[model samples]
Target: MTIVVAVDESSHASRVVEEANALANAFDDSLHVVYVLSRSDFVDMEETNVSETGDAMDLDRVREIAASVAEDAITDANATAESVGLVGDASSEVTRYADDIGARYIVVGGRKRSPVGKAVFGSVTQSILLNSRQPVVAIRKD
Candidate 1:
Protein backbone atom coordinates (compact mmCIF):
# COMPACT_ATOMS: atom_id res chain seq x y z
CA MET A 1 0.00 0.00 0.00
CA THR A 2 0.99 3.61 -0.49
CA ILE A 3 0.34 6.96 1.12
CA VAL A 4 -1.23 9.35 -1.36
CA VAL A 5 -0.82 13.08 -1.09
CA ALA A 6 -2.90 15.44 -3.20
CA VAL A 7 -0.74 18.27 -4.45
CA ASP A 8 -1.93 21.66 -5.71
CA GLU A 9 -0.65 25.22 -6.11
CA SER A 10 -1.90 26.25 -2.70
CA SER A 11 0.58 27.42 -0.07
CA HIS A 12 -0.58 24.66 2.26
CA ALA A 13 0.56 21.98 -0.18
CA SER A 14 4.06 21.80 1.24
CA ARG A 15 2.74 21.16 4.70
CA VAL A 16 0.48 18.45 3.36
CA VAL A 17 3.46 16.84 1.63
CA GLU A 18 5.54 16.94 4.78
CA GLU A 19 2.75 15.31 6.72
CA ALA A 20 2.32 12.64 4.07
CA ASN A 21 6.03 11.90 4.03
CA ALA A 22 6.05 11.49 7.77
CA LEU A 23 3.09 9.17 7.64
CA ALA A 24 4.62 7.13 4.85
CA ASN A 25 7.84 6.81 6.82
CA ALA A 26 6.00 5.69 9.93
CA PHE A 27 3.91 3.17 8.03
CA ASP A 28 6.78 1.94 5.84
CA ASP A 29 4.83 2.71 2.71
CA SER A 30 5.75 4.46 -0.50
CA LEU A 31 4.57 8.02 -1.08
CA HIS A 32 2.64 9.06 -4.14
CA VAL A 33 2.02 12.72 -4.94
CA VAL A 34 -0.87 13.43 -7.26
CA TYR A 35 -1.80 16.66 -9.03
CA VAL A 36 -5.08 16.97 -10.86
CA LEU A 37 -5.57 19.54 -13.61
CA SER A 38 -9.22 20.32 -13.87
CA ARG A 39 -11.06 21.43 -16.99
CA SER A 40 -11.64 24.77 -15.25
CA ASP A 41 -7.89 25.31 -15.12
CA PHE A 42 -7.70 24.97 -18.89
CA VAL A 43 -10.67 27.29 -19.31
CA ASP A 44 -9.08 29.85 -17.02
CA MET A 45 -5.79 29.69 -18.91
CA GLU A 46 -7.60 30.23 -22.19
CA GLU A 47 -9.77 33.01 -20.80
CA THR A 48 -6.77 34.76 -19.24
CA ASN A 49 -4.57 34.24 -22.29
CA VAL A 50 -1.62 32.76 -20.42
CA SER A 51 0.36 32.36 -23.60
CA GLU A 52 2.57 35.28 -24.61
CA THR A 53 2.14 34.58 -28.34
CA GLY A 54 -1.67 34.92 -28.09
CA ASP A 55 -1.94 31.43 -29.58
CA ALA A 56 -4.65 29.06 -28.48
CA MET A 57 -3.01 26.61 -26.07
CA ASP A 58 -3.70 22.97 -26.70
CA LEU A 59 -4.19 20.20 -24.05
CA ASP A 60 -0.51 19.17 -24.29
CA ARG A 61 0.62 22.72 -23.48
CA VAL A 62 -1.78 22.90 -20.57
CA ARG A 63 -0.58 19.52 -19.30
CA GLU A 64 3.00 20.73 -19.50
CA ILE A 65 2.16 23.79 -17.42
CA ALA A 66 0.36 21.68 -14.86
CA ALA A 67 3.23 19.17 -14.77
CA SER A 68 5.73 21.96 -14.15
CA VAL A 69 3.69 23.20 -11.21
CA ALA A 70 3.33 19.68 -9.87
CA GLU A 71 7.10 19.23 -10.14
CA ASP A 72 7.58 22.32 -7.98
CA ALA A 73 5.21 20.84 -5.39
CA ILE A 74 7.09 17.52 -5.50
CA THR A 75 10.36 19.33 -4.92
CA ASP A 76 8.81 20.91 -1.87
CA ALA A 77 7.61 17.46 -0.85
CA ASN A 78 11.35 16.72 -0.29
CA ALA A 79 11.66 14.22 -3.16
CA THR A 80 12.15 11.21 -0.91
CA ALA A 81 10.62 7.91 -1.94
CA GLU A 82 7.89 9.79 -3.74
CA SER A 83 6.51 9.30 -7.23
CA VAL A 84 4.37 12.00 -8.80
CA GLY A 85 1.29 11.41 -10.94
CA LEU A 86 -1.10 13.72 -12.76
CA VAL A 87 -4.68 13.43 -13.96
CA GLY A 88 -7.82 15.53 -14.48
CA ASP A 89 -10.85 16.17 -12.23
CA ALA A 90 -9.13 17.44 -9.10
CA SER A 91 -11.10 15.78 -6.32
CA SER A 92 -12.53 12.68 -7.95
CA GLU A 93 -9.36 11.79 -9.78
CA VAL A 94 -7.25 11.95 -6.66
CA THR A 95 -9.62 9.67 -4.81
CA ARG A 96 -9.89 7.28 -7.73
CA TYR A 97 -6.14 7.06 -8.11
CA ALA A 98 -5.69 6.41 -4.42
CA ASP A 99 -8.27 3.65 -4.58
CA ASP A 100 -6.64 2.13 -7.61
CA ILE A 101 -3.24 2.22 -5.95
CA GLY A 102 -4.58 0.80 -2.71
CA ALA A 103 -3.47 3.75 -0.69
CA ARG A 104 -3.52 3.48 3.07
CA TYR A 105 -4.13 7.17 3.59
CA ILE A 106 -5.03 10.20 1.52
CA VAL A 107 -3.29 13.41 2.56
CA VAL A 108 -4.52 16.87 1.60
CA GLY A 109 -4.19 20.48 2.60
CA GLY A 110 -6.99 22.29 4.39
CA ARG A 111 -7.66 25.99 4.05
CA LYS A 112 -9.29 27.92 6.83
CA ARG A 113 -12.70 29.02 5.60
CA SER A 114 -15.80 30.25 7.29
CA PRO A 115 -18.99 28.24 6.93
CA VAL A 116 -20.38 30.77 4.47
CA GLY A 117 -17.10 30.79 2.57
CA LYS A 118 -17.07 27.00 2.33
CA ALA A 119 -20.62 27.11 1.10
CA VAL A 120 -19.75 29.72 -1.49
CA PHE A 121 -16.57 27.97 -2.68
CA GLY A 122 -16.73 24.23 -2.43
CA SER A 123 -13.41 22.73 -1.32
CA VAL A 124 -11.45 19.87 -2.92
CA THR A 125 -10.26 18.90 0.54
CA GLN A 126 -13.84 18.58 1.68
CA SER A 127 -14.67 16.49 -1.36
CA ILE A 128 -11.72 14.14 -0.70
CA LEU A 129 -12.61 13.86 2.96
CA LEU A 130 -16.19 12.94 2.13
CA ASN A 131 -15.49 10.70 -0.84
CA SER A 132 -12.33 8.79 0.03
CA ARG A 133 -12.68 5.37 1.59
CA GLN A 134 -9.11 5.48 2.79
CA PRO A 135 -8.19 7.37 5.95
CA VAL A 136 -7.41 11.04 5.34
CA VAL A 137 -5.04 13.53 6.92
CA ALA A 138 -5.56 17.26 6.47
CA ILE A 139 -2.62 19.57 7.13
CA ARG A 140 -3.20 23.29 7.44
CA LYS A 141 -0.83 25.99 6.26
CA ASP A 142 1.77 27.08 8.75
Candidate 2:
Protein backbone atom coordinates (compact mmCIF):
# COMPACT_ATOMS: atom_id res chain seq x y z
CA MET A 1 0.00 0.00 0.00
CA THR A 2 0.99 3.64 -0.34
CA ILE A 3 1.30 6.31 2.34
CA VAL A 4 0.84 9.94 1.34
CA VAL A 5 2.15 12.72 3.52
CA ALA A 6 1.28 16.38 2.94
CA VAL A 7 3.55 19.13 4.21
CA ASP A 8 4.14 22.87 4.15
CA GLU A 9 7.32 24.90 4.70
CA SER A 10 7.20 24.59 8.43
CA SER A 11 9.31 22.92 11.10
CA HIS A 12 6.55 20.44 11.67
CA ALA A 13 6.93 19.22 8.10
CA SER A 14 10.12 17.33 8.86
CA ARG A 15 8.54 15.61 11.83
CA VAL A 16 5.44 14.70 9.88
CA VAL A 17 7.56 13.23 7.07
CA GLU A 18 9.63 11.26 9.53
CA GLU A 19 6.56 9.77 11.13
CA ALA A 20 5.14 8.87 7.77
CA ASN A 21 8.49 7.40 6.70
CA ALA A 22 8.48 5.08 9.71
CA LEU A 23 4.96 4.00 8.90
CA ALA A 24 5.91 3.33 5.30
CA ASN A 25 8.97 1.32 6.28
CA ALA A 26 7.00 -0.79 8.73
CA PHE A 27 4.44 -1.76 6.14
CA ASP A 28 6.94 -1.98 3.26
CA ASP A 29 4.94 0.70 1.49
CA SER A 30 5.97 3.39 -0.92
CA LEU A 31 5.89 7.00 0.31
CA HIS A 32 4.97 10.09 -1.57
CA VAL A 33 5.74 13.36 0.22
CA VAL A 34 3.69 16.27 -1.02
CA TYR A 35 4.12 20.00 -0.65
CA VAL A 36 1.11 22.05 -1.62
CA LEU A 37 1.68 25.60 -2.80
CA SER A 38 -1.43 27.08 -1.26
CA ARG A 39 -2.93 29.52 -3.73
CA SER A 40 -4.75 31.17 -0.88
CA ASP A 41 -1.56 31.70 1.05
CA PHE A 42 0.83 33.01 -1.62
CA VAL A 43 -1.36 34.76 -4.17
CA ASP A 44 -1.99 37.75 -1.95
CA MET A 45 1.53 37.65 -0.64
CA GLU A 46 2.66 37.44 -4.23
CA GLU A 47 0.90 40.73 -4.95
CA THR A 48 2.17 42.55 -1.87
CA ASN A 49 5.77 41.32 -2.04
CA VAL A 50 6.61 39.99 -5.43
CA SER A 51 10.34 39.76 -4.79
CA GLU A 52 10.04 37.66 -1.65
CA THR A 53 7.26 35.63 -3.23
CA GLY A 54 9.50 34.41 -6.04
CA ASP A 55 11.83 32.69 -3.61
CA ALA A 56 9.00 31.07 -1.66
CA MET A 57 7.60 29.61 -4.86
CA ASP A 58 10.56 27.29 -5.03
CA LEU A 59 9.49 24.20 -3.12
CA ASP A 60 12.85 22.45 -3.28
CA ARG A 61 13.63 23.05 0.37
CA VAL A 62 10.47 21.36 1.52
CA ARG A 63 10.96 18.51 -0.90
CA GLU A 64 14.54 18.00 0.16
CA ILE A 65 13.56 17.75 3.79
CA ALA A 66 11.09 14.99 3.06
CA ALA A 67 13.58 13.18 0.86
CA SER A 68 16.24 13.24 3.53
CA VAL A 69 13.85 12.02 6.16
CA ALA A 70 12.64 9.24 3.95
CA GLU A 71 16.22 8.22 3.24
CA ASP A 72 17.16 8.20 6.90
CA ALA A 73 14.08 6.34 8.06
CA ILE A 74 14.05 3.57 5.51
CA THR A 75 14.30 0.15 7.09
CA ASP A 76 13.29 -1.70 3.96
CA ALA A 77 15.72 -1.26 1.10
CA ASN A 78 13.02 -1.89 -1.47
CA ALA A 79 10.67 0.74 -0.09
CA THR A 80 10.54 3.73 -2.41
CA ALA A 81 9.73 7.42 -1.83
CA GLU A 82 9.36 10.49 -4.00
CA SER A 83 8.36 14.11 -3.49
CA VAL A 84 5.37 15.74 -5.16
CA GLY A 85 4.68 19.43 -5.63
CA LEU A 86 1.13 20.66 -5.98
CA VAL A 87 -0.83 23.87 -6.30
CA GLY A 88 -4.36 24.23 -4.84
CA ASP A 89 -6.21 23.93 -1.57
CA ALA A 90 -4.05 21.78 0.71
CA SER A 91 -6.85 19.59 1.98
CA SER A 92 -8.47 18.96 -1.37
CA GLU A 93 -5.23 18.28 -3.22
CA VAL A 94 -3.95 15.92 -0.55
CA THR A 95 -7.15 13.91 -0.26
CA ARG A 96 -7.52 13.73 -3.99
CA TYR A 97 -3.98 12.46 -4.42
CA ALA A 98 -4.51 9.87 -1.72
CA ASP A 99 -7.69 8.68 -3.35
CA ASP A 100 -6.09 8.67 -6.77
CA ILE A 101 -3.21 6.55 -5.55
CA GLY A 102 -5.40 4.44 -3.30
CA ALA A 103 -3.24 5.31 -0.32
CA ARG A 104 -3.42 3.34 2.86
CA TYR A 105 -3.24 6.55 4.90
CA ILE A 106 -3.05 10.32 4.47
CA VAL A 107 -0.53 11.69 6.93
CA VAL A 108 -0.52 15.30 8.08
CA GLY A 109 0.67 17.60 10.83
CA GLY A 110 -1.91 18.96 13.25
CA ARG A 111 -1.61 22.70 13.60
CA LYS A 112 -4.17 23.17 16.32
CA ARG A 113 -7.84 22.99 17.19
CA SER A 114 -10.30 25.52 15.93
CA PRO A 115 -11.34 28.32 18.24
CA VAL A 116 -14.94 27.20 17.82
CA GLY A 117 -14.40 23.82 19.50
CA LYS A 118 -11.60 22.11 21.33
CA ALA A 119 -12.21 18.87 19.51
CA VAL A 120 -12.58 20.60 16.16
CA PHE A 121 -9.34 20.74 14.18
CA GLY A 122 -7.91 23.68 12.34
CA SER A 123 -9.30 24.06 8.84
CA VAL A 124 -6.78 22.08 6.78
CA THR A 125 -6.47 19.13 9.14
CA GLN A 126 -10.20 19.01 9.76
CA SER A 127 -10.96 19.15 6.07
CA ILE A 128 -8.59 16.29 5.22
CA LEU A 129 -9.92 14.13 8.02
CA LEU A 130 -13.50 14.77 7.01
CA ASN A 131 -13.11 14.47 3.24
CA SER A 132 -10.53 11.73 2.71
CA ARG A 133 -11.82 8.24 1.89
CA GLN A 134 -8.56 6.71 3.13
CA PRO A 135 -7.61 6.71 6.80
CA VAL A 136 -5.71 9.76 8.09
CA VAL A 137 -2.77 9.93 10.49
CA ALA A 138 -1.99 13.37 11.90
CA ILE A 139 1.15 14.04 13.90
CA ARG A 140 0.58 16.73 16.50
CA LYS A 141 3.01 19.64 16.20
CA ASP A 142 5.06 20.60 19.19
Candidate 3:
Protein backbone atom coordinates (compact mmCIF):
# COMPACT_ATOMS: atom_id res chain seq x y z
CA MET A 1 0.00 0.00 0.00
CA THR A 2 1.00 3.58 -0.52
CA ILE A 3 0.22 6.90 1.12
CA VAL A 4 -0.03 9.93 -1.14
CA VAL A 5 0.72 13.33 0.36
CA ALA A 6 -0.07 16.46 -1.59
CA VAL A 7 2.37 19.27 -0.91
CA ASP A 8 3.64 22.63 -2.10
CA GLU A 9 6.62 24.82 -1.23
CA SER A 10 4.21 26.97 0.76
CA SER A 11 1.66 25.69 3.29
CA HIS A 12 2.35 23.43 6.24
CA ALA A 13 3.90 20.69 4.16
CA SER A 14 6.08 19.35 6.95
CA ARG A 15 3.10 18.93 9.24
CA VAL A 16 1.14 17.11 6.58
CA VAL A 17 4.05 14.87 5.73
CA GLU A 18 4.68 14.12 9.39
CA GLU A 19 1.13 12.92 9.85
CA ALA A 20 1.23 10.94 6.64
CA ASN A 21 4.50 9.34 7.67
CA ALA A 22 2.95 8.17 10.92
CA LEU A 23 0.10 6.60 9.00
CA ALA A 24 2.51 4.98 6.55
CA ASN A 25 4.53 3.49 9.39
CA ALA A 26 1.38 2.14 11.00
CA PHE A 27 0.21 0.63 7.72
CA ASP A 28 3.65 -0.46 6.45
CA ASP A 29 3.20 1.59 3.31
CA SER A 30 5.52 3.58 1.11
CA LEU A 31 5.00 7.33 0.79
CA HIS A 32 4.70 9.45 -2.31
CA VAL A 33 4.96 13.23 -2.11
CA VAL A 34 3.48 15.22 -4.96
CA TYR A 35 3.68 18.90 -5.89
CA VAL A 36 1.24 20.26 -8.40
CA LEU A 37 1.65 23.57 -10.22
CA SER A 38 -1.78 25.10 -10.47
CA ARG A 39 -3.00 27.50 -13.13
CA SER A 40 -2.32 30.38 -10.81
CA ASP A 41 1.27 29.28 -10.35
CA PHE A 42 1.69 29.17 -14.09
CA VAL A 43 0.25 32.62 -14.45
CA ASP A 44 2.52 33.95 -11.73
CA MET A 45 5.48 32.25 -13.33
CA GLU A 46 4.61 33.91 -16.58
CA GLU A 47 4.42 37.35 -15.02
CA THR A 48 7.78 37.25 -13.26
CA ASN A 49 9.86 34.55 -14.90
CA VAL A 50 13.58 35.15 -15.26
CA SER A 51 16.59 32.89 -15.00
CA GLU A 52 20.05 33.70 -13.65
CA THR A 53 21.26 34.19 -17.22
CA GLY A 54 18.47 36.72 -17.82
CA ASP A 55 16.53 34.31 -20.05
CA ALA A 56 12.93 33.58 -19.25
CA MET A 57 12.36 30.49 -17.16
CA ASP A 58 11.04 27.65 -19.24
CA LEU A 59 8.45 24.99 -18.50
CA ASP A 60 11.23 22.54 -17.71
CA ARG A 61 12.44 24.88 -14.98
CA VAL A 62 8.95 25.16 -13.61
CA ARG A 63 8.74 21.38 -13.54
CA GLU A 64 12.08 21.19 -11.78
CA ILE A 65 10.82 23.65 -9.17
CA ALA A 66 7.79 21.46 -8.70
CA ALA A 67 9.96 18.40 -8.13
CA SER A 68 12.14 20.31 -5.72
CA VAL A 69 9.13 21.49 -3.78
CA ALA A 70 7.89 17.94 -3.31
CA GLU A 71 11.31 16.62 -2.40
CA ASP A 72 12.05 19.45 -0.02
CA ALA A 73 8.72 19.18 1.72
CA ILE A 74 9.43 15.58 2.69
CA THR A 75 12.95 16.23 4.02
CA ASP A 76 11.73 16.41 7.64
CA ALA A 77 9.76 13.22 7.24
CA ASN A 78 11.08 10.12 9.01
CA ALA A 79 10.79 7.82 6.02
CA THR A 80 12.32 8.27 2.59
CA ALA A 81 9.59 9.21 0.15
CA GLU A 82 9.27 9.35 -3.62
CA SER A 83 8.54 12.78 -5.04
CA VAL A 84 6.63 13.66 -8.21
CA GLY A 85 5.85 16.93 -9.96
CA LEU A 86 3.00 17.65 -12.32
CA VAL A 87 1.35 20.60 -13.97
CA GLY A 88 -2.42 21.06 -13.89
CA ASP A 89 -5.18 21.72 -11.43
CA ALA A 90 -4.04 20.94 -7.89
CA SER A 91 -7.26 19.24 -6.82
CA SER A 92 -7.65 16.94 -9.81
CA GLU A 93 -3.96 16.24 -10.15
CA VAL A 94 -3.56 15.20 -6.52
CA THR A 95 -6.58 12.90 -6.68
CA ARG A 96 -5.48 11.47 -10.00
CA TYR A 97 -2.00 10.84 -8.67
CA ALA A 98 -3.38 9.04 -5.63
CA ASP A 99 -5.68 6.91 -7.75
CA ASP A 100 -2.87 6.11 -10.17
CA ILE A 101 -0.65 4.96 -7.33
CA GLY A 102 -3.41 2.96 -5.72
CA ALA A 103 -2.81 4.92 -2.56
CA ARG A 104 -4.58 3.74 0.58
CA TYR A 105 -4.85 7.29 1.79
CA ILE A 106 -4.47 10.88 0.60
CA VAL A 107 -3.03 13.43 2.99
CA VAL A 108 -3.27 17.19 2.47
CA GLY A 109 -2.63 20.37 4.45
CA GLY A 110 -5.98 22.11 4.65
CA ARG A 111 -5.97 25.85 5.17
CA LYS A 112 -8.94 27.05 7.13
CA ARG A 113 -11.17 29.37 5.18
CA SER A 114 -14.55 30.92 5.73
CA PRO A 115 -17.49 29.50 3.81
CA VAL A 116 -17.72 32.74 1.87
CA GLY A 117 -14.03 32.66 1.17
CA LYS A 118 -14.17 29.13 -0.12
CA ALA A 119 -17.18 29.89 -2.25
CA VAL A 120 -15.42 32.86 -3.81
CA PHE A 121 -11.85 31.61 -4.15
CA GLY A 122 -12.40 27.89 -4.16
CA SER A 123 -10.35 25.52 -2.02
CA VAL A 124 -8.05 22.89 -3.46
CA THR A 125 -8.13 20.97 -0.20
CA GLN A 126 -11.88 20.98 -0.16
CA SER A 127 -12.03 19.73 -3.73
CA ILE A 128 -9.62 16.89 -2.96
CA LEU A 129 -11.67 15.86 0.06
CA LEU A 130 -14.81 15.56 -1.99
CA ASN A 131 -13.33 13.96 -5.11
CA SER A 132 -10.57 11.59 -4.10
CA ARG A 133 -11.24 7.86 -4.20
CA GLN A 134 -8.68 7.22 -1.48
CA PRO A 135 -9.41 7.88 2.15
CA VAL A 136 -8.47 11.48 2.93
CA VAL A 137 -6.46 12.65 5.93
CA ALA A 138 -6.58 16.41 6.37
CA ILE A 139 -3.89 18.21 8.38
CA ARG A 140 -4.90 21.73 9.19
CA LYS A 141 -2.22 24.38 9.39
CA ASP A 142 -1.29 25.62 12.84
Candidate 4:
Protein backbone atom coordinates (compact mmCIF):
# COMPACT_ATOMS: atom_id res chain seq x y z
CA MET A 1 0.00 0.00 0.00
CA THR A 2 1.08 3.55 -0.72
CA ILE A 3 -0.05 6.49 1.39
CA VAL A 4 -0.02 9.97 -0.09
CA VAL A 5 0.05 13.17 1.89
CA ALA A 6 -0.68 16.68 0.58
CA VAL A 7 1.50 18.90 2.71
CA ASP A 8 2.25 22.59 2.86
CA GLU A 9 4.18 24.92 5.18
CA SER A 10 1.24 25.20 7.54
CA SER A 11 1.64 23.91 11.09
CA HIS A 12 -1.35 21.64 10.59
CA ALA A 13 0.52 19.89 7.81
CA SER A 14 2.93 18.43 10.37
CA ARG A 15 0.17 16.62 12.20
CA VAL A 16 -1.23 15.29 8.98
CA VAL A 17 2.20 14.02 7.97
CA GLU A 18 2.63 12.31 11.31
CA GLU A 19 -0.80 10.70 11.09
CA ALA A 20 -0.18 9.52 7.56
CA ASN A 21 3.19 8.14 8.54
CA ALA A 22 1.73 6.24 11.46
CA LEU A 23 -0.86 4.66 9.24
CA ALA A 24 1.68 3.81 6.58
CA ASN A 25 4.07 2.34 9.12
CA ALA A 26 1.31 0.20 10.54
CA PHE A 27 0.46 -1.12 7.11
CA ASP A 28 4.12 -1.42 6.05
CA ASP A 29 3.35 0.88 3.16
CA SER A 30 5.49 3.40 1.39
CA LEU A 31 4.80 7.08 1.95
CA HIS A 32 4.55 9.74 -0.74
CA VAL A 33 4.71 13.48 -0.04
CA VAL A 34 3.15 15.91 -2.50
CA TYR A 35 3.30 19.71 -2.33
CA VAL A 36 1.10 21.61 -4.74
CA LEU A 37 2.41 25.05 -5.71
CA SER A 38 -0.44 26.96 -7.22
CA ARG A 39 0.42 28.24 -10.69
CA SER A 40 -0.40 31.73 -9.55
CA ASP A 41 2.32 31.43 -6.97
CA PHE A 42 4.94 30.66 -9.58
CA VAL A 43 4.28 33.80 -11.58
CA ASP A 44 7.03 36.39 -11.88
CA MET A 45 6.04 39.03 -9.41
CA GLU A 46 8.47 41.58 -10.83
CA GLU A 47 6.78 41.48 -14.20
CA THR A 48 3.49 42.40 -12.62
CA ASN A 49 5.23 45.17 -10.74
CA VAL A 50 6.19 46.65 -14.14
CA SER A 51 8.97 48.70 -12.58
CA GLU A 52 11.70 46.13 -12.45
CA THR A 53 14.14 45.32 -15.24
CA GLY A 54 16.96 42.78 -15.64
CA ASP A 55 15.48 40.75 -12.84
CA ALA A 56 15.04 37.04 -13.30
CA MET A 57 12.19 35.04 -11.86
CA ASP A 58 13.06 33.77 -8.44
CA LEU A 59 12.47 30.17 -9.33
CA ASP A 60 15.44 29.06 -7.30
CA ARG A 61 13.99 30.57 -4.19
CA VAL A 62 10.64 28.98 -4.84
CA ARG A 63 12.25 25.64 -5.48
CA GLU A 64 14.25 25.94 -2.31
CA ILE A 65 11.18 26.58 -0.22
CA ALA A 66 9.23 23.77 -1.82
CA ALA A 67 12.15 21.39 -1.31
CA SER A 68 12.47 22.44 2.29
CA VAL A 69 8.82 21.75 2.97
CA ALA A 70 8.96 18.37 1.31
CA GLU A 71 12.17 17.45 3.10
CA ASP A 72 10.79 18.37 6.49
CA ALA A 73 7.64 16.37 5.97
CA ILE A 74 9.49 13.33 4.69
CA THR A 75 12.03 13.52 7.48
CA ASP A 76 9.35 13.76 10.13
CA ALA A 77 7.50 10.87 8.57
CA ASN A 78 10.72 8.80 8.62
CA ALA A 79 9.68 6.68 5.70
CA THR A 80 11.04 6.34 2.20
CA ALA A 81 8.98 7.30 -0.82
CA GLU A 82 8.63 9.85 -3.58
CA SER A 83 8.30 13.61 -3.12
CA VAL A 84 6.98 15.89 -5.82
CA GLY A 85 6.06 19.52 -6.35
CA LEU A 86 3.08 19.99 -8.60
CA VAL A 87 1.67 23.14 -10.15
CA GLY A 88 -2.11 23.35 -9.96
CA ASP A 89 -5.05 23.50 -7.63
CA ALA A 90 -4.33 21.65 -4.41
CA SER A 91 -7.25 19.25 -4.58
CA SER A 92 -6.92 18.52 -8.26
CA GLU A 93 -3.18 17.94 -8.14
CA VAL A 94 -3.41 15.79 -5.04
CA THR A 95 -6.12 13.60 -6.50
CA ARG A 96 -4.14 13.15 -9.69
CA TYR A 97 -1.00 12.28 -7.73
CA ALA A 98 -2.95 9.78 -5.68
CA ASP A 99 -4.12 8.09 -8.83
CA ASP A 100 -0.68 8.12 -10.37
CA ILE A 101 0.92 6.60 -7.30
CA GLY A 102 -1.82 4.02 -6.86
CA ALA A 103 -2.22 5.37 -3.39
CA ARG A 104 -4.40 3.36 -1.07
CA TYR A 105 -4.91 6.33 1.20
CA ILE A 106 -4.59 10.12 1.02
CA VAL A 107 -4.19 12.63 3.82
CA VAL A 108 -4.83 16.37 3.75
CA GLY A 109 -4.69 19.06 6.39
CA GLY A 110 -7.48 21.62 6.56
CA ARG A 111 -8.12 24.68 8.60
CA LYS A 112 -10.12 24.32 11.75
CA ARG A 113 -13.17 26.46 12.33
CA SER A 114 -12.45 29.96 11.15
CA PRO A 115 -14.08 33.35 10.91
CA VAL A 116 -16.16 34.42 7.93
CA GLY A 117 -15.47 32.31 4.87
CA LYS A 118 -12.08 31.02 5.95
CA ALA A 119 -13.50 27.81 7.32
CA VAL A 120 -13.24 24.63 5.33
CA PHE A 121 -16.70 23.45 4.53
CA GLY A 122 -17.81 19.87 4.88
CA SER A 123 -18.83 20.03 1.26
CA VAL A 124 -15.27 20.69 0.16
CA THR A 125 -14.02 17.69 2.03
CA GLN A 126 -16.97 15.73 0.76
CA SER A 127 -16.06 16.65 -2.79
CA ILE A 128 -12.54 15.31 -2.40
CA LEU A 129 -13.89 12.22 -0.75
CA LEU A 130 -16.30 11.77 -3.60
CA ASN A 131 -13.67 12.34 -6.27
CA SER A 132 -11.13 9.97 -4.81
CA ARG A 133 -11.52 6.24 -4.99
CA GLN A 134 -8.99 5.79 -2.20
CA PRO A 135 -9.87 6.70 1.34
CA VAL A 136 -9.15 10.32 2.32
CA VAL A 137 -8.33 11.41 5.84
CA ALA A 138 -8.88 15.09 6.54
CA ILE A 139 -6.86 16.39 9.49
CA ARG A 140 -7.92 19.53 11.26
CA LYS A 141 -5.75 21.64 13.49
CA ASP A 142 -6.64 22.42 17.07
Highest lDDT scorer: 3
- In candidate 1, what residue range of length 10 has the lowest lDDT sum? 79-88
- Every model's TM-score: 0.80, 0.70, 0.85, 0.74
In model 2, the runs with Cα more than 4 Å from the true position are: 41-80, 117-122
- Stretches of candidate 1 off by over 4 Å are 44-64, 81-87
lDDT of 2 at 110: 86
lDDT of 1 by residue, 5-39 (tens): 88888876777778888898899898887777788
User: For this target, which candidate reaches the highest TM-score against the unseen true structure?
Assistant: 3
Please estimate how well model 2 matches the true structure, expressed as its whole-model Cα lDDT: 0.73
Candidate 3's residue-wise lDDT over 1-142, tens digit each?
9999999777478888889889999999999889999878876786775533556767877878788888888886655888888889999999998888799999999888999999999998999999999889999888
Our tally of clashes for model 2 stands at: 0
Model 2 / residue 75 / CA error / Å: 16
Model 2 C-alpha lDDT per residue in residues 6-120, reported as the tens digit of each score: 7766666777877888899899998988767667654655555557564443445444543454444332223347767666788998899899889999998886666786455
- How many clashes in each structure? 0, 0, 0, 0
